[model samples]
Target: MSASTKPIGSARGPAGPLESRPVEDSGRRGLTDRVYEEIKALVMDHGIEPGARVGIESLARRLEVSPTPVREALARLESDGLVTKRSQAGYRATELLSVEGLVDLFDMRRLLEPRAAALAAVHATDEQLDHLETTVEGMRSHPVTGERYLVYRRFAALDQEFHDTLAAASGRPLLAQAVQRLHTHLHMFRLNTAPGDALTTVDEHDRVLRAVLRRNPDRAAEAMEQHLSGSWERHIAVMDGNPAKK
Candidate 1:
């Protein structure tokens, strides 16, 4: 992605200047929410490059809104870990995860997720198992082909939901919260545009779900480990500039 920090408002689309889009409501909160989604999309889509400074006034001008809403949006983004505030400089998009960061992230996952899956095998309610089945089925419909993030955004969302539901079903609130805080799917999707191994991902999720549905703790744990290992390899391949094998 380009490191240039261009004004978001300068780009015109089929509709018009993004700033020219209408807000749904006249309420202050509504305006702020709209601004938040707009800016969030920019950040997520890398319209603003990683580690690039975000100018409040420029964004406000581009969005055709006051600085107040932009500031509010930035604060919310900060909580989401998409941006960071500096002491005196300003806000900047969070940098892409480094190789070491990726390793640490997977370390945490391997520590928590397999255990969570094992617990889920013993503790998941019928509803939660159904939800997992539904989510995996949903994923199968969203066939990912190219390297565009937008193309596989739905798959990414469902993938997150599958892991999250499994964690929640472990009957451990702390574990679920910890996994959510990692924001694993968001960071992984943001790491690069390559939608790594969608078909293989679906198959892996199916294996994990089947094990959980059968209430086999050892099997579930094993499946989860394999899934994470495969996922880590795919991401590492992307980072090394190789197309992940499907």
Candidate 2:
């Protein structure tokens, strides 16, 4: 899609138009955040195709923002693994993870996330638990199908939020940061446009949430481990030319 065709401060995915924070109502930091979010949506929706060079001035013109905020947003996106900067080459959207990269990502997640779930089970506040439940419900609301990434962006976003929230609830800031740095959902969602296992994913999340809600660290860890293993298998199947069942 042409950058000029997209409206400033708004992004469209297959589901609908994603709302943006008004740049005029916020301070510098808020403006940067808005720019960051809009750019992220554009990248996620493939409006800015993967590996395409991102022109700061062009993006600024497209979003009707100054280059400052666009620069700041691109820096943040680089950290999020959604974009990358090259020496003397400026910024470009990062390519989707390879099969080997996916394997490595899941290996690290298997080590970290199960522990995070265990810790969250023991240390999470009631409010955090409530939020987790609400997020899962939100996922339920956005069922996945044989559609493009834009069509299931809400599900993808909620999936990220659920994991991020669980990681933070572990009461381990460093661990939470590590999990966030992985950007697992973003990379995985970008890996395949048609995700067919929405119901299975939601059910797996429900299992993890239930164990955490019950304050069962072992069970929570086990549930998380199972979920990750299952997820890895599902993605592997997709990569192998077979989509997982819905």
Instruction: Report every candidate's CA lDDT.
Output: 0.82, 0.82
Error of 2 at 177 (Å): 1.8
Clashing residue pairs in candidate 2, if any? none
Model 2 residue 222 distance off true place after TM-score fit, in angstroms: 1.3
User: What lDDT does candidate 1 reach at residue 230?
Assistant: 93
Error of 2 at 81 (Å): 1.2
List model 1 lDDT by residue over 124-210, tens digit each. 999999999999999998866543444666887898999999999999999998987888887887775454478899999999999
> Can you tell me which runs of candidate 1 are displaced by over 4 Å?
1-33, 145-149, 242-246
Worst 10-residue lDDT window, candidate 2: 8-17
Q: After superposing candidate 2, which stretches have Cα over 4 Å from the reference?
A: 1-34, 145-150, 242-246
Candidate 2 has a TM-score of 0.80
Residue 170 Cα positional deviation in candidate 1, in Å, after optimal superposition: 0.7
Ten-residue region with minimum lDDT total, candidate 1 = 8-17
Kindly provide the TM-score of model 1 when superposed on the true structure, using C-alpha atoms: 0.84
